[model samples]
Target: MGDRQDAETFNNLLAAFGMARGKLQLPCVPALKARYVQKVIALANLLEKPLTSAQVEELETAIAQELAKGFQASQHSQLLISFQPNPKSVEQLDFKITCQIASLAEFYEAALKDNFATDSDQLDRLETSVFGKHANARVLDLLPELGDPETTTILDIGAGSGRNALPLARSGYAVDAIELADTFCQQLQQQAKTENLPLSIIQGNILDPLLRPKLNHYALAILSELLVHFRDADQARLALAKACDAVSKSGLVLFNIFLCRPDYQPTIADRQVAQVAQSFFLTPAELESVMDGLPLELVDRHSVFDYERDRLPSSAWPPSPWFINWATGRLLFDLEPPPISLQWLLCRRI
Candidate 1:
């Protein structure tokens, strides 16, 4: 920030605030609704010099109190917000806060790092993290649908650390694993090599147009626990299009997606908020709209939690501590029946 011009930095901050609140979904968060959007202060005008440590804290408090007004009603929870600075540049912040309210800026800051990019340190923590802590219960249960591992080929897009892919390969199914994070790819590669599994690791983003896999080549494509990471329903749409392109005719695509209730109309801001909380959500209608013209047919959709719960033994009620919270939409809300939930969806190519 020291290197950036003040004006540029200020503009960026303003944009971040606007984005965090969301222009399209502002109504969902009443405090940040129409009038508030027009009233956000230009902090630049208030401060001519750099902020002192104490001043920053004061600002954060004041801001959090305001954001809390909306946050309390905005469906956000008091989950641990994490941050990891670059090992070289910024000093690491080793701190945690528990409070009645958290500012939108705090969430915005956290969202910036939530993406497990090449530079992010999340890869080192994925194993300890609840994500991919266990092979997706739905993916494991639905494996037989792919049929004849000896001859079937499977594509696991966004395959983090080979959670599902490794198990499939070990079962003798030829697997192609695509991942966006370098460390995750390397982790999967090392494990695959150790067992000499038939899994091929590809380091790429499924969203990249140039990262094309063979068209109509795979018997099945598994995208379990991945779509919610996409920026919006549109990005999910693109990935599904790619999945449709990769699976052969009559082949299938199975994905675990977080979806809002059909009757629930989430504002764009609501979706943005969901993403910041480590979940990206879409409506069933939006999903149908995505696969509308594709050569894909929706075969079935089941509640992920219900399927896994009814199958896994009582002792293994939740595969991980965060599994129930995340899979049932508690990550975004504390409701008994969260308006959103994870769903196991399967589609077949025409």
Candidate 2:
């Protein structure tokens, strides 16, 4: 353990753990764990001396601790990974452990079958936990660019809490909001009444046939963060087509879509998250293909982050919620194998 080779071997093991750590989600954990085990063996072989049972236990426990930390961070999408090597931690490991180390794969497998309800209360709790009440300023900034605010008739599809709808209505534009969630629809209606804003709050699915006839002739159609809920690409395309049809000839439609990494396939955890959302993450090319034959033309494509960074509080630091988001965005920008990106697509009828 005195030689530089010993130190280097430990570093390699830690680095391999880091690599496998990234792939520790439900579907890929087994394969990734195999790679992690290989690294553990490589470290043992490098020592040349046979490790005592105590040493082996210590090493495995240390790795498990780090993996647990990673698992906790992964639960929050806003977290930025801070990967500082803790080589000294191995010295602190005690051989007092009697229980078998809990498997990361087991945790993920059980999570996949989690019985959390997707009811209104669950949705409300989930939304409250992950996001704040503030609407994205980028969506608001694009409103004026679409057309004049005074006379424009804006239809907000899936307008949760009237984030964009209420603001547009308050700005003197006529706004119609369609929300499927009963609680959200009621809240939006109550807010609009309090503000005395001109808003039409329809508590129903945006695709409902009865709602379609009433949604027509809008100057601007806002579909922000809604396309991801469609069952598939074909359905997304149909939804986009419907949004286009609802707008006037001169109107524009703005929506958001998530683009997956070109090289990396989604893991089971990724699919599970998408399934819960009723969404599919597509690559930019796949999204383009979905809209290929549609009459709608892409007017502009915006990076959601570009408009959001400045809005972050200046005091964010030490991994605050906003800091984590900023750090995650920065890391992904420079990440060797890109993950996924949330992008805004602005389109107009031909």
Best by TM-score: 1
Task: Give one digit per residue, the lDDT tens place, for model 2 in 1-350.
Answer: 45766656676555345421111122212213334444554544453323456666665565455444543333211112112223554322222211122232233223323532245455433323223345555566666666777777888887865657866888889888887765566667777787888888877666555666343588778887676555457767767777888888867888877677677676755543453332346766778888988778888876555545566344321212542333233322345433666567888877
Q: Which ten residues in a row have the lowest lDDT in candidate 1?
A: 19-28
Off by over 4 Å in 2: 1-133, 146-148, 213-216, 265-269, 277-279, 311-337
Candidates in order have lDDT scores of 0.68, 0.57
- The deviation in Å at residue 251 for candidate 1 is 0.7
Give the per-residue lDDT digits (tens) of candidate 1, residues 1-350: 57876656666455333221111122223333334322322322232223346534654554455445545533443422222222332222222223233333344334335644334465545543535445667677667777888998989998876667877899999999988766677778877888899999988878888999889999988897778766667788889999999999999898878888877777766675676565788787887787789898888889988998887667656766678888899877766578899899989999
lDDT at residue 236 of model 1 (Cα atoms):
89
Off by over 4 Å in 1: 1-134, 313-317
- In angstroms, the error of model 2 at 183 is 1.0
Give candidate 1's root-mean-square deviation (CA, Å): 13.4
Q: What TM-score number comes out for model 1?
A: 0.65
TM-score of each: 0.65, 0.56
Model 2, residue 188: distance off in Å is 0.7
